[model samples]
Target chain A: MSDSIPDVKKVGALLLEIGGLLMSSGASSERIRITTNRIAEAFGYSCDLLITHRALMISVNSNNSNEFFSSLKRTSPHGVNFTVVSGISKMSWKIVEENWSIELIKEEMARLKSISAYPRWLTLVLVGLAGSAFCFLFGGAGLEMAVTFTATVAGLYVRQESHKLKFNPYLNVFFGSVTASMISGLLSKFDWGTNPETAFATSVLFLIPGVPLINSFTDLMDGNIMNGVIRGFNGLMIALAIALGMLVSLMIYQM
Target chain B: MEDAVLILEKGFWFAAAAIGFAALFNVPRRVLWVVGLLGALGGITKTLLITQHQSVIVASLAGSILIGILSVIAAHGKHAPPLIFSIPAVIPMVPGAYMYRMMLGFINLTATLNSENYAQLLYDTLHNALNAVFILMALALGVSAPMLVTRKESVKNLKLKRN
Candidate 1:
């Protein structure tokens, strides 16, 4: 609607780039589809949004895709809002169009979330079992309960807490895991409940950054170079956070 | 029966917790709850499936794909974004805990200078680390399967129209 003719192709390319970034950040296919739709609305176009893990591909009927991209490159701010980059290749576009949609994608995402250690109330039962096991391992009862209590509490809070304060989700998890781990270590020193491994495991289960890391590697394997690298870096940072948290705890306890 | 009721109550709360987290990740709250429920069901069924000698990876993958499709079912009616539900629902399956355990195992093994504990520590750590890697791979595959399938369906439809 702006007097300037919106370069539909470039806009499509931009959408793809944003899509790549979002996916790399661990957004699901559905999220990317909705985002692409929103972005298209922002740019004054009704595009058929085709999103995949590695790219956002749009089919625009308004103009030649290449020319539209050039005009978009010209009109965009010299720096900040969008980093000018090579447009998505036809092959890449085809791949994306082949793999993604705005259809029922929720079940998959939910299923993924269920694999965490603190997933169900059954997790509480598992925590109880773990506590008993820890008791058997360390020859002890009271300590594990405290650990379980603390871990469950931590798990509950981790869900409610804001990710905006997070430098990275992985870092948030690392700190959280460390907090749980330290509590376990201290409780163990007091000979409380089988050394609290169960509690620590239960609480820190929410902190694992496994999915993002795997996505990064898969994207790379799928030939999404930029997407893979960015996601892989994020995964690395998360893993590092966990490793660091554990290392620091170990050093402090002289374990 | 009482135990079953208790499990359902707790399951709903946990599912609610998962949905709440999914919402924070920017999924639409309503659709996410439904997907979360199905995912919980799939997750529960997964335990049975595995026990029944069904492949864990296939069951997990199918369960996730079902979650993905069911969430998208409302896309046309709501004009809603599918990711709003899908991404959050998938968060539980990400395998972050396994990686954490592996790291813990490695740390425990390395810090233990006692030779008697060394082999046991090393073996456990390696086994966990390997499991973490494989699960991570499965999670990725599970996430991507629906996307790939949809693309194929779309292409087929397009070709059908042309013919």
Candidate 2:
């Protein structure tokens, strides 16, 4: 597995970059550890990779080499991007199997990065449908579901726009939740459907802490207790933000 | 027959929701349908169990176990981690209503001036919140069970390969 010992600095940088990309894309710490290690081992080197909430570090040494290559990358706060994680997962294997040169791997990663999951309009449509699905599942009939579909489409648009503007994510959830809930509240107030109560609730389901909650538990199960606590705390804060928006809407409706 | 149809509808919508969220999360296009199917499976199982009068904890745990097993199989087939599927697949079962109800209950408990109803509201809030918490915990544990087991097996295989 040994060729001209790959340039340590270049390999270390790539490993850290992979770590940053995976973590920022919301891949869990454990997966980041295993994936980066595999990629390193495949490149005819051995490394220690540590992935945490704020940063990822990789250090590599060849048994016969005196100097070590190490790099640390800070992870950005990110929403889940499963496509990137899966792409890197698959690409790492391909690199091993094909014995891809570093330049080839770099070119592939850039190509993968350019592939958006869906166009903006499609994302909006699908998220709107998701909101409608939740409404229907919770007992909304056709009218309420339609209202939610529209409300959610608009709400998600606001969320996306705010995110692009670099608004804090929790604040985006708060504002987005309030706007969606208020409109749905108006629909329910007028007796628009068989289950008005459900319409009011499900529109905000889009903002629920589904991933963070599950990630926290999984992190804890994997003995990453600090990460578990961090994720759990972050999720609780988002939940509180959601609750705040809903409660505020409730107050407005009462008034 | 009507019951089966209603259950079928629930499953369909849950899968639809899964696809929606999966898209939002940017799941790899190649495997999106499998994730949707897994979500449907979990949703139908939970809905059926609830119809049978199973407690929320039991229903959620059972549902997530199905998701867990399916994700492990999918994890292997897809050559990716199980969480990539399980996370979005579990979204349809999130206790959003309970969370809202708990918050609403808190509002009432706080706004009231220590009246008899305040005690009731406090209890109600705590009860609903606890249900949300417990069901959530059940889901996480259930989904992780299969992943952890398979992960251990995979690790063993890797070590064997090294030798």
Candidate 3:
């Protein structure tokens, strides 16, 4: 529609970058496809996206001229960052609404990418607090709840440390669960909590694959069977890791 | 009165836990509390059904359905996609104790050498593991039912392209 020949290749590459980022950041395939298409069309190009569990491929055609350019990107599965998804979706909407030029769109994209997350300590504390709250919800009262809080806090710290040190993700989860259950298991022996068993059981609540499970389930129902099943299997493996770690601690304590 | 207090307390913790999970995953602060409240609603709904004698499976299904619907509405209201709210809302209902118990059962069953209780422990372990798996499946299906209707259609995806 625009008289200037839109650089279909550049636009396609940008769109592909965004898609891969969203995929790696844990967006469902549906969301990634829709958002990438929306952003591309706003700039006078038609986008076709093929999203898989490990990579994203995208091609765009300049309107009328029909000159097409494609990009292929290798993407690793990363942890969920919902705020990033939320922000990027909104940004796509704004791109079309304001009729922003390609330059403006690219700038906005980088800004979204660079946005800093909350402080590490804050995230650690909040997650610890959350795990402790779930422990209470599960009937751990008073001292049991307190131990759950402390155990989860320490466990999350270990998880973060492992992540920082670049440990394998599965190993990070296993070790985190091991640490959490170990704390709860060992402390419960000394009357530190009324429901030591409950603490040991509940601290691993933080490690549940709830997000992946939810996403994969939606993916399956939406007919993206491959991505859905892959993610579901991945979630199952995480659950198994959690179970194994908990069992290891239980076996040690024999409680 | 006692029942009401217990329900309220559970709701409170569920809300707190939801907020914590959201934070841990770095959900933005602007809509952070709203997601937590949605999780609380789900927790309260399921807790009420359980106390009223519903099966845990049925209660979880009902609760996740509630969460999925609320997440859809919240997404529109907050101008965000639904996953941001839905995923965290679903976390509070996870059956952690049963999962752990199932693992414990397996460890005990395998570690013991010629025990008469092996069959019973095997059964209990299988039952707990199945229960956990089934609850997770129920949660997924419940949420999926609502989310299917909310997919961004081709038209809506390009809604702002008119300019």
* Top-TM-score candidate index: 2
User: What is the lDDT ranking, best to worst?
Assistant: 2, 3, 1
Model 1, span B38-92: residue lDDT tens: 5465444444455578865665666566656654553333334343444445545
Q: lDDT, candidate 2, residue A112?
A: 69
**Model 3, docking class:** medium
Question: How would you encode candidate 1's per-residue C-alpha lDDT over A133-200 as one tens digit per residue?
Answer: 32222223455645655654454344335244644555556666576566666654455554455445
* CA lDDT, every model vs. true structure: 0.49, 0.83, 0.81
Clashes of each: 34, 0, 0
The deviation in Å at residue A245 for candidate 3 is 2.4
DockQ of each: 0.10, 0.72, 0.71
Tell me candidate 2's fraction of native contacts, as a decimal between 0 and 1.
0.83
lDDT of 2 by residue, B1-163 (tens): 9999988888989998998888888888888899899999999999989989999889999999999888877877777767789888988888877877887777777678868677778788999999988989999998888867666723323323224
Residue B156, candidate 1: C-alpha displacement in angstroms:
14
| Candidate 2's TM-score | 0.94
Fnat per model, in the order given?
0.05, 0.83, 0.82
